[model samples]
Target: MNMKRNSVGDKVFDCFNLTGLFILVGLILYPLLFVAIASLSEPDQIYNAAFLLWPKGFQLESYRIVMENPDIWIGFVNTIVYTVSGTLISMILSVLGAYPLSRSDFKGRRFFSFFITFTIFFSAIGGMIPLYFVIDKLGMLNTMWSAILPGGVVVLNMIIIRSYFETKIPMEVQESAALDGCGNFRLLFSIILPLSKPVLAIMILFYFVHHWNAFFYALIFITEKDKYPLQLVLREILVNNNLNNLLPTMTDQNYLERLKQQQSLKYAAIVITTLPVLVLYPFVSKHFKEGLLVGSVKG
Candidate 1:
């Protein structure tokens, strides 16, 4: 078989496309690269340079400081707890909700699905005040449950899972399982869940990342410093510049030095917070595109 040859215009287009993609990649990557470099670079050197391609006057002081901070460690633990618990709750609720809606024979499936989707739009229309009042009425304010329970089921994620269940899993397979004396719970746990790993993996990744990075809810609900998640703690450092608690008391002589170190500390905190998501993506990435494509297409 003969392969089609590229015309001159096609060749030019390919070159331009490749060039544009490379530039876009660079634009995306450079900020992350700069942050990583800045975390290691000498604090003074960071401000001195216009653009960083590499670490300047490398030092481990910023990392050492971050690691030594008890609050960072506390925040790290709190974040892990919240992420794991919240993700589990979200996934469980989403799967339970999605599975029922996916079944054509399930009564009120359309009504329930429409109701869930309606909440999404309602949520967009200044729902935060109502939600806060609900949380308060439930007496969950200033507790971990406030952060975890309120956003337990994301409508869009549930919709994706429902779409995947409807389109990917054939009705015959379910009927066969039923005929073989499988109960609904058994079939869901044994057969449906096992076959739905790709979509599940993607959903887990989505929920995990969201919980890991979430801070707004934490900020509103958690008043105690100890209860703050990693992102909330990071917000104090990066947004509020409240490092006095993190840093040791400084004498007048070294106050300027400590101030300079704050720059590196900010970058170091960013690296630490972002590292988990970066590490996690590679594991579930293979399922990401296929799962998202199939799940979204039908819905």
Candidate 2:
């Protein structure tokens, strides 16, 4: 066997790639680190540019202010409900939808797949006005369903999962299950699902993140303050900067403090909103990579 080493060109390319990767990692990590530090930092310190690498002055006032708001607590609960329920609905539907499409023996699978792909290329988001009318007709207006039902199964997620199932699973496995008298449901639950941990975990994460970060849907559908999601509450804080509801005792006396608080609150809100996903990512990220098993199975 000719066990020749990599050429000089390949060695140089590897070094170049590592350097690029290091730079890319720094580019991404620095901003995230800054957001976290800035959230814990004093807004005046940020304005002064005393330090950017770490919290210029560690302060919990912003977080305390944000947490003490009644609306924020209500919104947090509503958001948790929405994210968990929405992710469940989306994942189940996407997996079910993908299964039939993944089966090569299913007639017109290719045609149906093309239909799906075509929509991905051309699908436009429906206007909120028209969508509102439909939601109203369904009696979903001002309801959590208004947010969850409208986005039941994202087409792009379905497409990805269908591709995963189609290629990663072997036809031989299905045949063996059939020989063991396994019906479709049995084969799916007892076999495929058991084997699809990684993909399902990834799908759950994707759906969870999508629903958690969703604000526009809540903004249009939920009028009741208690029904608002965390993103909407954060939007109210960060964009509108309306802390009047939280502190009706606002006077010229403490006005400047409130203003300063809002600035820090913006960063704090971002950090608080993002913390769950950040904490969740490390657990699922390895599984997601395992799920994307390129060149691991035959068609």
Candidate 3:
């Protein structure tokens, strides 16, 4: 009877603990919710502070202005290009590098691994001028390959992938493949990569987010506004002193209305930038915990 009573008390405590955790999370996330709601609220009501939780007067004007800017669409396209291309490149290189590092029999493998790993600890702090000089020397400036080639592989992601391959892929299986006339490329593509879906998914998510949000590279290498990524375009609109790009067509009264509208649209643009990862993450989130743990383990 006492045990049963104790169990009941424990259950009640657990329930309250969960509820408190949720309330705490809600408190933290409220600002984001408020920003989202405020973005859609009416300009007059926003200025008046009449709306708190709900939008006082709903308006799509901010989005309309944001959409009207030609650069925004161009930047969106560029961002898509950069993200997709960069992610593919990152995955290919990381996979190739990690697969080799997973093997102990490869000649000078430890030396090679140390060589590759050396870049992670060091910081390169030179600005656009030095990078520009190097790119110019290579004659890659103003080219699409400029963006694609510079950051093709991320060292940290590669380390995670290599760890996963080392821990998860059995040495006996690889040895069997070797005996059966399977070469490095065939074993990697046909065996290793196929079984590394979880870690690969996590790497894809990481590289995708990195490439999508990258602006400094584009800002320096891409002189053409047509090549500007979405982040750069957003920076120009929000941080840089260039309001004319989005607000050029607005008249005096409409300009005031538009400026107010942009205040909300800025948040909406953030939501737009953030939306893809949110959508992609949930579908692959199940693998994240397993992949990250397995892929990053030492042994």
Candidate 4:
């Protein structure tokens, strides 16, 4: 076997590649680190933009403001409800919709597939206006259903799930189950779902993040302030930060201190809102990786 050797030019290119990679990593990681540090730093430091990679001072005043607000808790609870319920709804519809479409022997499979792909490139016949009217007629306005139903199952994601089922799951296994008198429902849940952990985990995470970050639908469809999701509440917080007196019992001097903490509060709110999802990513990261790699490449 011939020995592998790097020429001077290749060595230079390798050094450049490593330098560029380091710069790219720093670019991505520095912002997250900076935000975390700035959240805990004194407000004036944030206003002055003094904190670089590390925080200059330690302060919990911004977190205190966020924690003291009872409405923020209500928003958290509402967001959790919406995310969990919405993800469940989304997965149910996606699986049901994807499963049938994945079967090779299903009637009109090519026709249905073409129709779905067509819609991806084209708008609906009446668009958002008619869709809103239908939703209003359903009396789903101002209810959680309004958030869950409007775009529960994305066609593109459904296609991904369909491709997963079509490729990752062997036809022989399905045929064996059918021989054992397993019906469609039994085959779907008992056989296919158990084998679809990687795809399912990724889908759940995707839908959860989508629902958690959703604000536009909640803004339009939800009427009550109590019903607002965390994102909406966070937006309102930033918009009215200086005006709202966080601690009424505090003296004027202390209140002014709190006003100075407005910028810090914005950073704190970002960390607080994003922390849960960030915490969640590791648990499903392996599945997410496997699913994307497998689902994205189909034979």
Candidate 5:
């Protein structure tokens, strides 16, 4: 009788768990669905919507207007450049710093580890004023390097990568590689990096998102209009209400209509900005489970 009751309770608990999981998923998905639906709807219909589930008055006008703007195109190109270059530099530096920290036998390992770890907690002093002054002194202000150099490598990412290497990679395997006349560079390039695809993918996605969404850096450093990143373009459209200012002589009669449609275009831009990471997730999602398990297991 006790076993029978326990079995019934287990079944009830399982049903409740599934129900809760679906509810949580629904909570997260509903807003994105609403935004997507609103983005495709006519602005008047969208404003009327209390809870947008589908396009009330289907329209592609927002996308057309956004595409028509030349500054938007320039900013999009600048954003792509920043994201790609930033991710590459971040990965290269992160891997180099992480590998040495992974080695327990390396001299001054603790000090080096502490030094890298220290950056994670400590906020930059004088936040942007002194940084601006320093960049000006280096003559990097108003240049591409200003965006790239300030965020070369993130400390938290380095620590996670180093932890993965220390816990997952066998010291014995590295010793075997060294015996086979492999130098540190060859061992890292030929061995460790090949096996680090999952963490690297995650890092790339993280850094890409960071660089893509970065606005303040460009806003502060880049005085030149052409160097403005996509986020700055988005800011001009959304916050400043100054799309005309971006292009001084754009005297098109549809300017008011174009600005009205930016509400939908904002969400469309978000979806576009996020698409790279979304597309990438499917390719690396399977690897994450296995990779994380490997990293978590002690060497």
Candidate 6:
């Protein structure tokens, strides 16, 4: 059989599509590329350049300054702990909640699901004050648990996992397991979870990124500098411009030089903070499309 040849109109459409996509990809990538390059380039060159194509006067000084700060290291370690612990908590809660809701035999599943979903819209109407009060009442304020526990279950993620279970997993497989004297916990642990790797990987990626980049709750709840996450620490450097911690002892002689280096320092901090998510996406990317398509389609 001969393949159909592309007509003139189709060729034009394909060319336009390719051109648009290339431009879109460049638009998205340019800023990230600039930041990475700027982080390594000399401060004067970075400021003077209209756009960065490559590093100029390449040096590791910005990275050295960022790494040398005790706060940066503390925040990095804190972020890792929060990301790991929070992801584990979120996965456990989301799976446990979604599994039951996915079951047709489970009573009140619809009502429970509705109740959970209601919060998504209701939360948009304003709940920050109430949430703060509750956290304060529970004495979780200024604690690491404040950041990790409050967002332990994301509703959208749970719904996605539930949709994945209901639509992707075959009922016949579950029935077969049940017939072989498999109990709920055993079946879930041994069979169901193993087969649900794609969705689980996606969920892990979602929660991991969320927890890794979270700062709002930390900004509100964590007053102690040592307890701050990486994002919050970056905020101190980037937004507040509080580079006292990152800068070496300043005198009239080197004050201008240190101030110039601040630009590189800020870009370096952003790159450092962003690197983890970039590193993580590749590992779970294989499951991303499959899981997202199935998981998000129903809801």
- Tell me, by lDDT, which candidate is best: 6
RMSD of each: 1.7, 2.7, 3.1, 2.4, 3.6, 1.7
Candidate order, TM-score descending:
6, 1, 4, 2, 5, 3
Which scores better on lDDT, 4 or 5?
4
Q: Indicate whether candidate 1 or candidate 2 has the larger lDDT.
A: 1
lDDT of 4: 0.85
Q: How close is candidate 4 to the true structure, as a TM-score?
A: 0.91
What tens digits encode model 6's per-residue C-alpha lDDT throughout 1-299? 99999999999999999999999999999999999999999998977897999999999999998999999999999999999999999999999999999899999998998999998987632578888998999999999899998778899999999899888888899999999999888878887788889999999999999999899889888899989999999999988999988887788998778878999999999999999999999999999888888788873
Show pairs that collide, candidate 1: none
How well does model 5 score by local distance difference test? 0.78
Go through the candidates in order and give each one's C-alpha lDDT: 0.90, 0.82, 0.82, 0.85, 0.78, 0.91
Give candidate 5's error at residue 295 in angstroms.
3.4
lDDT of 4 by residue, 1-299 (tens): 99999999999999999999999999999899988999998887776775476776788878888777777788899999999999999999989988999999999999988988787788554666777788899998888888777767777878889989999999999999999999999999999999999999999988989898888878878889888888888888777653264545567768666666667878888899999899999989988767867876688
Any residue pairs clashing in model 2, and if so which? none
lDDT of 2 by residue, 1-299 (tens): 99989999999999999999999999999888887888888878877774489888899988887778788888889999999999999998988888888887889998988887787777645677888898899999899999898877788778777777767777799889989899888988888888778878888888999999887877888899889999888888777876665545768888777676667778877888888998999988888666755412335
Query: Clashes in candidate 6: how many?
Result: 0
lDDT of 6 at 241: 95
Pairs that collide in candidate 5 are none
Give the TM-score comparing model 3 with the true structure, all chains together.
0.87
Candidate 4 at 173: error in angstroms? 1.1
The worst-scoring run of ten residues by lDDT in candidate 1 lies at: 120-129
